[model samples]
Target: MCEQHRTDSALERHGAERSGQPRSCKPAEARRAVERAVTERCRATHTHCDPEALGDALLVASELTTNAILHGGGVTDFRVEVVAAGVRVSVSDRSDRLPVARDPADLRRRQRVGGHGWPIVCRLARDVRVSELPTGGKCITAVVALD
Candidate 1:
């Protein structure tokens, strides 16, 4: 169970750790990972993939990874998998701050700046959790239902 998953990006991320290179901080890479995992799972189970659900999951993935990079001091780690409930996305980063959603409308009823990501994630994901890592920093996990 401790065996490392060896996808090309996984290899790259693992290699980066050994060489003191930064882990993947790109949201694009995270989305790709989620896509591959969910799509492959659907194929394996002979399940019809839900396009809207997949899109929501990908958007959630993108929001989480982007938040980790923009606010959590880059992505320390990431994982995506298919579970009975849905597609799960997890992202870790070197920050203790939990994600917060700013009010949609601020003083004078004007929109806020750059605070929509967290809310979008919450709306799309069926479940969201943030945990403190023993090694420091934090991990955020979100489950988006496929059906």
Candidate 2:
């Protein structure tokens, strides 16, 4: 795995390495890499973060990565940062189309096949932001609390 350590900084970013590659196009692979990275780091350092919160982080990662692959034209990069308050995840994709949050009630009434990921992320994350990349596409970042 592509490990990064920055003792001087609170926000330390790291990548998932596989076969000498840091990026993966597949959503499942991306999600797995993210979960693995965070879980391993927490376990190795014996962080006080709760297991349930970690599970929520994994769910958020899966939702974001799936959205990126299905609508964002594949994932370009994935990064997880260790912060003072919690873990931060940033996902980069090829599409410029930003995600729209649909009302849960509306979704239930309309019977849509899929439209819940963004809303779910919003509910679970602390500071969620989406930035437009100059070259094209957008980066979605969400911070999951340790509690």
Candidate 3:
């Protein structure tokens, strides 16, 4: 696993407070770690983002990480960043398959136990992106606004 620590620096400026690591994690563990990372990033940045926003950010992070762990085979990398607008969480995994959200209407039609991740993520995040990593896997990024 690849572990990384990032801070505000001139040469390697990320324009935000951020930290990331590439590692394998189970669904439950990933959720806990994402929540912890969000807390740490907020404290480190000295930014008291809206409490509700923070909670939603943590939830979004957990959902994304869980999806990566369960659907993408394994979580290859995870990142949390405090940006001007809000917090951005990115999850990378071994699978190249992109995530799809079920139609909201269809979801009500079927009383299933699962498959609600991407839809919830889209609702909570200000912006969401999925891109193909050059090395074969895919990465999903979601941004939650502070306001």
Best by TM-score: 1
Local accuracy of candidate 2 as per-residue lDDT tens digits, 31-80: 56556656666766786657788877777888888888788987776777
Q: What are the runs in model 2 whose C-alpha is more than 4 Å off?
A: 1-22, 103-108
> Which 10 consecutive positions of candidate 3 have the poorest summed lDDT?
2-11
RMSD of 3: 4.1
Models sorted by lDDT, best on top: 1, 2, 3
Q: What is the lDDT of residue 116 in candidate 2?
A: 89
Error of 1 at 93 (Å): 0.7
lDDT of 3 by residue, 4-32 (tens): 32333311555543345445755555445
What ranking emerges by TM-score with the best candidate at the front? 1, 2, 3
TM-score against truth, every candidate: 0.83, 0.75, 0.74
Q: What clash pairs does model 2 have? A: none
Tell me the deviation in Å of residue 89 in model 2.
Answer: 0.8
Per-residue lDDT tens digits for candidate 1, residues 35-55, read 787777777678899999999
**What clash pairs does model 1 have?**
none
Each candidate: how many clashes?
A: 0, 0, 0
Model 3 stretches with alpha carbons more than 4 Å out: 1-21, 26-47, 103-108
- Regions of candidate 1 where Cα sits further than 4 Å from its true position: 1-22
> RMSD of model 1, in Å?
5.7
